[model samples]
Target: MSVTSAATGSGPSRWRAGLGRLAAGAALITAVASLPWLSGNDPALTVLRARSADQDPTPEQLTAVREQLGLDEGPFAHLAHWLGGLPRGDAGTSWVSGDAVLPQVTGAFAVSLTLMLGALAVTVAVAALACVRTLYLGSRRRLQRGRGAIGVAVLAALPKFLLASLLATVYGVWLGWLPSSGWQGPASMVLPSLALGVPSGAVIGGLLQQSLPAAFNEPWARTWHAYGFARGRVARHALRRALAGVLPQLLPTVVGLVGGAVAVEKIFNVPGLGRLALDAAIAQDLPPLQTATLSLILLGVAAGLLIQALRRALLGPALRDGALPALHAPAAARGRFTRWVVAVCALALLAVITAGLLRDPLHVDTAARLLPPSAAHPLGTDALGRDLLARLGHGASRTVALALVVTAVCALTGLLLGMTAQIGAGLTEVVSTMPAVLAGLLTTAVTGPSAWGAALAVCLVGWTPYAAQAAALLEQERASGHMLASLSFGAGPGYLLRHHLLPAVLPGVLRNALLRLPTTVLVLASLGFLGLGEQPPTAEWGRLLSENQPYVELAPWTVLGPACALVLLSVLALNGADAVAVRRRPASARTRPWSRGTGLRVKSGVSAG
Candidate 1:
């Protein structure tokens, strides 16, 4: 049976599993809900860390803060106290500011929701337009060249900060078309929207580009053309069909806007929950963190569920279950595959080189510590008096560098282990069934908090998913005619793997690696926020959040800078992944000269049968 048949047959089981999933989700949320009590660290110590004092907190001061905060009880006592308050309206107060967590979260939540909704609107509009444009352009063979792949690469790999900076310079400074960065009125939304929407558009366009070729070549489309239907009408019908194939790709990308919005909000100085969540995580304040997580999870889940429903309603679940064109290599375009090999290598090198150029962010000064945002100190000074902007840059560099390393490691591991049959299956089940977070938690427990350990933890947890993918790819291609032909030619297993299989596997592996990179960065940021990532003075994004969280009330930039950096890097990684994953060998490499024909499909692969 084919993959689609298996998927269709398993629908009943999927529905059953969804109920079990909902129950499990409730359980997970409940468990996370209790985190305020379960975090074994001393709340007073967390508060003290934020004091920014020249001298140690006197015993009297410590005792006073502890008594005032009621932290004198044992862990169980605190847990019991917090659980008891759950029956009523109270959740607790912020650890650092001593304000009501609910109020703070609600206010921040308002900002985040506004930004989220705006970004979502922008995403949808841009994505739809992008798909249409790509479809129209794709049908024009004269223009479909290496330029498209390069353009997609640049857009996908462009960091949110870079894009934000470009917008600020072009529109805000020079053209006076829009404000550089702010969230005062409706006008402020324009540039940020473009900043976010453009890359998302590129991703949407790439998805459409991938599947559009096949959709256009579907027998129905060819028949319409054969029947002498006008070109425009036939193109319209093919595009409509292509929409069903590509809309599903937008679901995950939309879910990812959470990270992108965080960066955009911080860059534009928009007060949003992305900033709030980072601060909460940094401060190790359970209530606000809990509130933010609960809200985001619920929102994300809802949006995802809504998109899933939309896919079924508009596209139908049978799109996957039905015979359709896949978003794989266009068999006619093998020459352009070499170009992607070059792009992949260049992208990796560019990341590492960028990491090397960032300035050290840990050099501190006592006098400038905790300064608010000023012209001189653009992102202000953290509690350690290190420049927040500098730290953010360095932290982003570090995060990307480590994530790249980890992604490479994961890809290689998956490729190697996926070659085995029994071992691959066992590992797949283990990785699929078990959560990466659990592995991260255990690795951090063993290694403690450091840069390399964080990388190790990420690799340990992240590899399984990649391995599962790699194993599946291997299985799919192993039975292909090319492999069978090579085997029948008496090609040794090693030669077949090295020449035939590896070439087939490498591009897919590269795509998967790119896809996994953003996820790696997010995981590292989360771990860093938990004090399990790179230590301060070394300046990781999560570490900056952890350190400056207490100062958020005094200098918002301290929190926003790192938060924006985190989100920007994530978006960059995600966009790059999406851009490259759907990338195909450019058809122009195989097409006849543009002057020869109408730049349309001259020698089509599948015909109207």
Candidate 2:
């Protein structure tokens, strides 16, 4: 069936899906609006403390604050009031500032929107540049394999905050080419845009690079070539085809850009919605926080809908004809060289972890503060005189352990739900829109910020990607000839699942979990950096980076250890994922009936029958 037909279904089904999405969105909004009650903390006290940290208010003053802020009403009534006022441009009043929430949110959103737009442009440019050679080369698969692949992987692995720090240090402090902090003008937009865009763009570019080769190798492209179609025209058509497959990922990419902007804004000191939300969460200011959360949700939903529309448009005639190929895992470029790279990264990581474990991470020497690398302090000391080597070693376990737990949970949940087809796309899309940082804010309001809260926040939304992947893979598997043959032979669901589906889907899911490890580490570290995870004196990679960021210029060594460790971790996870893909390619190629040679044979046999 065509992509659109499969995706949209009949008119009634489309309506039902649309209604389902609306219901999910409403339910999400309702839950967010009820945060005041869901959080056990008294709204009055929270606001009072946020407003005046020094003064402790009495019962009468607390009661007055409650009455003024409408906390006297039940949570439902407050939600109703907020919902009622939303259409009229009233988002209620901020308890901390006593200002209107709508204006503050709007202003912040405008700034964020500007940054998102600039970042979006950069994302497109980078993706295009990455793909240009692949498109030009057309079907030259060998030539496309390794060119700049490592660089792209490295770029994809660099987290936004680290990149922002590097950009600020180089451009803002050292070179004096651009203003690094604050949103001043077009010039000020460059660093943050690059910082936010590069990683996401690399990811998008990598996917496109993989997809375009497959698209170009499709029978229709060969037919067009035979008919003397221009290479450029064929490439454009192939790009559109490839994009239809990749467009679903754009929703997460866009949402992630907005989410990553929280830390990016903090680093650059921009007054965007993400920063605003973070600040509100920190102060327990629910009014603006709620508004900001709702706005981000709306933005995500709108972006999803728009991207869906674009996908349908891109599908064009293929929607009716089913000319596009079924999507599958992209084969990794294979070689001994790739294996050697992976081994090297793994060894380096192990060395870092091992060396760190033997040292005293908490040992403080006032005289050794900001000491450069020496015999005693291999990685140098921080401003507080704590050994960087010990901290990094100790922090590796903390970071990697948390990441592993989160990844495993997300993978298992996603795989189960996906295999059973239990979670609807609408709900998954809505839930996936909530970034870990935003979720952290909500969790912090209820449980207070801690390592567990960060983990909880990550767990809440991290499963969506895996679930989406499982669902897609399940669908692809279901359409395979072996599956059809088994079904025709009256194989029960249980038998098919046990004998066929599990074996086919489990490896991909596990590989996905491995690939996602780096991101989980980054998210956990981001939370720590934001002070929402692992409070002071505990060695966590994110916290280390956060603590040492300010002294980046004065003591570059302080930040280098954690920063390099993060990059290496990312590279390791990526290479490991690639290795897994390469290892599985031979078996997958033989079993997959849709593969080039096998696909043609299958099609011919079906036509003959």
Candidate 3:
């Protein structure tokens, strides 16, 4: 048999792997050490330099000042010099605060890390509980499944930002259960964490609910039962088996939460990494922006990689031992006509929703000379003569485009990196959990408050999630017996992925990206409202809200119009995603393909001979 050949012969490959790891480590270290010089041109530093320069006595003194800061050196020279100094444990001084930049950034990171961890903890706990209930509440009955699906649909359809805002307003603003608009102590973390975690938890819940039922009903689960295993043991083993399916989807969910937490940071005035990113971006500080972006990327990559590794460990031996079998054939063909009807109905509803925003009917007193909702001007005119409806259509298009851009960029990068095997589990973990606020801060600092710049920043920070998720799926597939089937037929890694792995993982990736679209749009809008995206006269939804804040008392429609559009569009996109998942159920779950006694026995006390 060629079994040993597939599993053995690795000296050269091991050496090559070692070399690659060394190279990656060196590059990351070099990037970290030189970040100060790279990000030194930030507006804050420029102002600091100018201030320091003005106080100088002579040309010699000015030159000396430049020399002292290594401003005279070229960027490469400066980076090298900084890298050289880092081995001695010196990260240099911040031009703004005259403090060590490393320590300050690290301290800021510590605060942000704590917040991220807390939020992640909350999400995991909440999601686990929700998923467990959805899975075990009913005995695999059709009605229970329908209710669970409906719950997921409702949760998925709501926008995270709108959810957070509403929760903040109701729980914090009205009830005063938690402080709103600022961070103080641990108490401040509760509301934002809930707001961020709930939507994320719901996402996890949906995936688990979908995966668990099939996993439990599989032959393996039946085998465990046949062995006289307890229900608890069967449930645990089934969940563990199902988790292989769930982990890949989680990478993006966590990253999305990172983005949401950024908005929460701003709302609550939390000085976490998300806030740092926001501040940096708003101030156009390039150095901070660069640092923040790199940090976020690394964190996200590391997180993703870790998750992938866990999936590999769980799914690997089964593949090597020829236990897990390859799936054959596509899923059942859904009703084409029904799908078309649903799509058409959705489009029609979208049109009606657009008209409601555009056309408004209200009474206006002629003597007041005030514009009320009327046929001549629907939704009324904003402070400017521009129709709210026209602006909204443009805004919706822009929002959707930006969301798609972020999703596309992230997805493509992830696929490329995953295919190339460049982004491993360790890298994803280090990169994906990055503080959204920090990325926003750094980007605004460098890019000078433009939407394109924000989009770029979002892409840079967001790519890790998709990459991590894709890489995890890739590793899981490779560790399954399925990869061996491809190899046995003489398929190369690339061919195997394209023909097998890609098809398996693409559905989950696309579903996740679509689900995340609304949230990304809301993030862009929040940044815009905070004066971090488009400058005035650009007419962005966020910018519109900010401009009309004062007039909110007299006429809230200006602010409400864009807000409604944002909320509605976000909800519509999420609904579409749930619909897609429901329509195209995968083959593995539908047919129960795995043999009862053949696949590796889960640790369910279910003996298989």
Candidate 4:
């Protein structure tokens, strides 16, 4: 069945509808792309050009320049010309360099693509493992779910640039296990990828928690038990069905990550597109900027389309099947999936922590320090040199650590503030309206660029979202039967919250937290780019780009690499979260067959424990 049929439950005109949507999307892209050339004479673009130019030319010269750039053509003709150029694989020329735009874009695109693909691979693998184990195998679902929820909250709240800086500090500065900067070889890829992946993992873990419980209630999932299907089979089926709904939501994440890549490339000194984009932005080079932006938009579209395809493949048939009938499965079997998910997550967490602690020892060589990019140093050396590879190894450790720490702090702080405000209405009223952007900027300005200061700023700015979500969750609980139940049991406020309120609000807490990571990462990376991260000579994706700011015009590769890395990391994390969230979301289903038919075997021993 096609998407249209699935959505409308109509006849065979579905394909036509799909085609129409695709056409509309393409039309939008075409129109947007042509705007710069067609409206090149617009006051804003003209003013910007004048401001950037070294010398003020006469109105005649400015008009001539604009006309030569296609401003003389009518909007329709200009758009048509631009459209015609696309068929010849032309992205046009750079206004600044006078070089063919396509070649430069192609080279940078290759490196950026490599970094994104690699980082995405790591993100998907780590997130899948964390989610499956956390949801299916842990001993205490409540505890694991709670911790995972908090982790998501924290990761979402902290900034990505901050995460990158901390990792550099711990692994590069303290341990000295890896090279400090430059993306010349395989060694340079490590820290950036890790920095990109950790926050993503936290996000995926939390999304799984939210979406999985909902899946538990789906009709097909319930029906599987009636067919005596294995627990794993049932779960796999449910998750597949859920992913259909989640992946589209993740598209923005992919776009954001690509944006962050600029900083990640800079910090670790990887020569990817992100770094190039940063340089272009700073230097106001229209060619590279256009290339970077276009590439990012394309990536976003691709990721979005991929998600849609997956959804069609999995969800189309399921929706056609309509609501499923319930099945009676053994309690042991019913709980098996949950057990496995929990166990896997626990083991994975242990492995990661262990790897961080026992990975390797540092071996520095003062003689090899500060090498430039060349045949001897393909990626070149950082300010301190020390073999870029070694710095990366240690840098990975530090980046991962920072992501984790920031995530943890953000979660704890957000939760506390949220819960406190929920109990204290006056505080909630005041804090709820405070804007995150303002708060973040103010905090950064006040604290400067140290790791602690950044983290504090992020946490403070990020608290508002958590507080809002929690306050709403608490208000809902305040009116529910559970509130009366706790009061009747003589449970004190703390006891009631611990026993009842927390569990009810757990799902939303998890969802919001996971959703926050990519945003935090973007903010942090931008700040770093603006020189608000760990102090100088310290390699961060943003800082790396900053160091190479001078050469962006000549050597775009330096900035492109790290910027791409940053973007990929954020996208993967967000995508993973979206996938998990979709998989775990509720499907239309009636109650379990047995529960509905008898409601007898499961005694109400405790409403909630």
For each predicted model, how many residue pairs clash, with residues at least 3 apart or on different chains?
A: 1, 0, 58, 71
Question: Per-residue CA lDDT of candidate 2, range 153-201, in tens?
Answer: 6777677788899899998988999998888788988999999899888
Please state the error at residue 242 of candidate 4 in Å. 3.8
TM-score of each: 0.59, 0.87, 0.72, 0.50
The segments of candidate 2 whose C-alpha lies over 4 angstroms from its true place after superposition are 1-5, 132-138, 209-238, 322-324, 329-337, 415-423, 468-512, 585-609
Cα shift from native, residue 401, model 1 (Å): 7.6
Quote the positional error of residue 577 for candidate 1 in Å.
Answer: 9.7
lDDT of 3 by residue, 357-423 (tens): 5533232234433255567656666665556655565555566677788888877876666554442
Query: What are the per-residue Cα lDDT tens digits for candidate 1 across 167-286?
Result: 776788779888776677778877776776666666566545544655555556657766877767766665665555455345435544543255456667776666666555445555
lDDT of 4 by residue, 1-609 (tens): 322233332564434434433443444334334434433335334434645653555777667666666555544664465456767888677655667877887777787676666666666666575567544642122222333443454454344544565566667666887655766766666677667766665555455544454455444455566677777776676566435434433443444444545556666776666666555543334445555556654564456446545655665544444321111111112234434544554454344334333423243456755555565444445444433333333344444456546665665665665564312222322222222222333344445456556556556545544554454344334443334443444556666565456654554555455466545544554555555555554544444545554444344444443444444444344434434433321111111111223432222221211
Top TM-score prediction, candidate number: 2
The candidate, 1 or 2, that scores higher on TM-score is 2
* Local error of candidate 3 at residue 384 (angstroms): 6.4
Best by lDDT: 2
How far does residue 265 in candidate 2 sit from its true spot (Å)?
1.2
TM-score between candidate 3 and the true structure: 0.72
Clashing pairs in 2: none
Residue 230 of model 2 has an lDDT of 83
Distance from true location, Cα of 329 in model 1, Å: 4.0
Give the candidate order by descending TM-score.
Answer: 2, 3, 1, 4
